[model samples]
Target: MQPIGTTLKQIRQAKGFTQKDVYGDIISRSFAIRLESGQHDLTAGKLFLILDRLGVSANEFRFIQNDYQATASELARSQIMLAYDQQNFPRISHLATRYAHSDNPAERQMAVLANVLIMAFDRREMVATPAMAQLWQQLTLTKTWTLQEIDFGPIILVLTVQKKQPLAATIRKYHLACERYVSAEADPFHVMDARAAFDLVALQLLLNHQQYATAQQFKSQLLAGETAHFTSDGNLDQQLSLWIWEGYFGDPTVAANRAEALRQIPSTRFKLGIDTLLSTWNKRAAAYHQRQK
Candidate 1:
């Protein structure tokens, strides 16, 4: 744990505030000195007053206290993203439950997205939860979205397709509106990220609809020059899963073998989950082959 007193002292020095300067209207200079020296305890109210004088929020103070790696909110978002990618349903559910009612708007939005994904992944025939239904309704009402919401495009599209939710038309209709919301021109990284998201979503939507020929054409475009251009592990998972579908009815063995090879590689991404998925696919493929023979 960081020493709060030391932290306060450092910030005071950085802000060019002497003990007398910080304590003028609040406490005595002697008390301030004692607080800074850890000779006296600072109450929460006094701490807030001091922080306000220093022009820092309690959240910002927490960030500094943690050595500035990431703010608490940021860490929570990362945890959710990692769990989502890993397809850890239990973890996702737990996170969704927590963030659904979070005071933070960003966290609440993430929670809605997580719940949507859970419905998609579950592939059940049940109706959407009232909360999820309302959230989706809100999202559909406007094309304007935060970049974080836009990043959800691919997953949302995939889930939409899987659930046969009739969103393809709406998405295409507002594609321009969606583009207007992005402020990526100033950031090349965001530019690439937005492009990748759109491409992945469009391709997956096609694949989900069993438009294999169309998906293949899109895949060709993605792999035109150097296929390695799309090296993200998530994209790799999508590609392999598509291969499994393509070969399933005929010679699924080919896709299964490819998956097995990928699983054996130490550098593979989504290692455990991918391996388990592939192992399961391989068994099904083998059974299909035996039945055919």
Candidate 2:
């Protein structure tokens, strides 16, 4: 990777920002010159502040510096998801802190989602904390949630239900919005991947609250819309959870067989965020027949 200062200077010049303009109280013009010349290195927080003033995200700057030329937010988000998949709490917490303090709302929302997912996975009793309520209101009111942010919907859904909030209609609305998002995607792979992730989340939330009717509704719609793409080849956590859902609301025989199959698979295959849900699903499956009778 090129020196951060060199990369910063390049981006600043490309943006037509003079040293004074880019420095703008964040640092002295001399400091900027020294930084660019590799004569000095700034602290992480200070570097981020300078980058913020330069109108370039740290992720974007890093990507450009590394010659990746990819979307920075997407790359960071993917890394966060991979951390969740690997059950790396330390990494998740670290990234959550980094993105939570980001100037970008998209990244901030993602950080909130990660924190909530971790809590949900750890089975922390969900109280309507001020932060939770604040995030809930923001997500509910904001129309900017798209692509990656769409995944945050499920985390918020689980939070709302666990907190005893009224959001059944909101849940349905989010599911519809996800459908629209998938429909608008140009790549079929992205569409199927998005839908599988979406359905997996929606089903997990609904089942957690014993909202079998709504779960069934989404399952039916998902099948109708993308039944062919809904195969075992999708995300493993999702596939296992979907099978558990099927057993809960569909034929017990199929669900039991699937759950047994799931049991044989290693728990490491699942996302940390979904482990609590998976455990709950299994426990629910065990008592489902008793409730029916």
Candidate 3:
């Protein structure tokens, strides 16, 4: 990988920003020169400050530095759903092992996350691992989570419900982050893009765990009285997901038709998730009926 300074220079130049523009008051021109020349390394504080000036995320800069391929963390994350859709345990296990020893903390976190995802998506029981304990500690201790934390935050929730642990704090943190993201003032469009995902994940998990009141509250918030908070009203994936949830909580016929609609679309990623949710609803309903008997 090229030096971070080299990456900064390339992005800065490509964006037509001078050292003066990007380093503006953040660092001296002499310091900037050394940074770009690879003579001086940037401290984390200054690196983030300068990165903000250049309008690039730390991850994005790293991607540019790595010759434009997705970083190990990014690649693992992107493949997570495909792994779920195809039930590719071996593929995901390979990913976990491949990146388990990375020097970068993000890559390592993704490795643990991959392991956790393998268990969580399959809805298998888990004995909490040291990695999971550490993940929670970090989440609880950090007042403001980074994009990575927010992205992986729901796995903790998924496993939390599976383990039948207390949900108050984990649920609170996930909602606060999503709440922050959906506001008009929220920046970092990519992170803002994750708001819907956090909502959907939390809603599904809450429903799966029979936290009906909490799940309905989330559903109400996501709908905002039928307004499209996440997208224009035309988004079929969102509509189907909401309908499926509604079918479970309210109208079965509406939900079935929505699921059928998604099924008819052979290429949609939403199909797998919706099918899994319907299965969850069926299991939960059967258990409820058994309890009544």
lDDT of 1 by residue, 184-207 (tens): 233322433344445544654454
- lDDT (10s digit) by residue, model 2, range 66-130: 87665546656777778876667788889888887888876776676678767755657765556
Over 220-255, each residue of candidate 3 has an lDDT whose tens digit, in order, gives 656542233345312543564476466556676776
Query: Rank by TM-score, descending?
Result: 3, 2, 1
Note the residue pairs that clash in candidate 2.
Answer: none
Error in Å for residue 39 of model 3: 4.0
Q: Identify the candidate with maximal TM-score.
A: 3
Off by over 4 Å in 2: 1-66, 69-72, 88-91, 97-107, 127-134, 143-145, 162-167, 182-189, 216-218, 227-238, 260-280, 291-293
C-alpha lDDT of residue 195 in model 3: 47
Error of 3 at 161 (Å): 2.8
In terms of lDDT, model 2 sits at: 0.68
Q: TM-scores across all candidates?
A: 0.54, 0.59, 0.73
